[model samples]
Target: MTSTTPRYLRPGKGTKVANAFARGVTKLGISLWGSRVLGVRGRTSGQLREVPVNLLTHEGAQYLVAARGETQWVRNLRAAGEGQLRLGRRVEKFGYRELADDEKPAVLRAYLARWKFEVGVFFDGVDASSPDETLRRIAPGYPVFEIRTA
Candidate 1:
């Protein structure tokens, strides 16, 4: 069956503004609602690329959800398999393991539950209360990575 999730959604002016604000706040040691700057080495350029992301902790494990779906950072994280998350002067180096499509529903649900107000539109109306089947259907579009401290 065809997936319902969008392949990509380019950031708009508003998104750029929000990201800049989040990055600025995070740089100042202020975590805006669990936001952090994720830095991954570019797959081709070999330079670090940074972007704002929401950090989700479920059952004591931390996760990174690619709300924008198949974004550049997602590709970089896939190729590099590790990266850093920064909040002010604190930097956490981490190894990432990509969750298989079938393994993502629970994580995705929890992620939506936490950031639905900010990222729900990207999920095509699926929310924390959505059925497993619905989340499963949209899982491929949202790349979820389990973060391990390095």
Candidate 2:
């Protein structure tokens, strides 16, 4: 079955609902089994946004990528550049930056290596060799960002 098809004992008309539910469950699983995630406050609206993103360590710097630019958490980060991330009982504020073309390949590679399975979504069709071109293509639309503890 394709990603669109939800796993089932058998296929039926409830596929859409099943697929949606499955996707939510999968996202929750990623958050739970993965590392801490942030709930950022919107700069203008004060809305709280959160997402399950990979926690990557590159050259001793901790990094998180905006794999999906459309995610609200990314938007909040872009607007404020600082927010809070919580894991278990700990929470801390962080400063974030949208990475430039030159800095993305290494981070992308690290992100890809850690969350190798979500490459298609994380990279958004980008690869190590052509990340610059991908960034250029996505520049006007979705771009990548990094976060640091504040």
Q: Estimate every model's Cα lDDT from 0 to 1.
A: 0.92, 0.59
Candidate 2: where are CA atoms >4 Å away? 1-34, 121-142
Listed in order, each prediction's TM-score against the native is 0.94, 0.63
lDDT of 2 by residue, 39-135 (tens): 7787688887654455677787777665544555666677876887665446678886777756666666666666656445444566555555665
Top of the candidates by TM-score: 1
RMSD of 2: 8.9
The lDDT, on a scale of 0 to 1, for candidate 2 is: 0.59
Candidate 1 residues lying further than 4 Å off, grouped into runs, are 1-6
lDDT (tens digit, per residue) of candidate 1 on 1-117: 966655878999999999999999998899988999999999999999999999999988999999888899998998998999999999999997889999999999999988899
- The model with the greatest lDDT is 1
lDDT of 1 at 92: 95
**What TM value does model 1 have?**
0.94
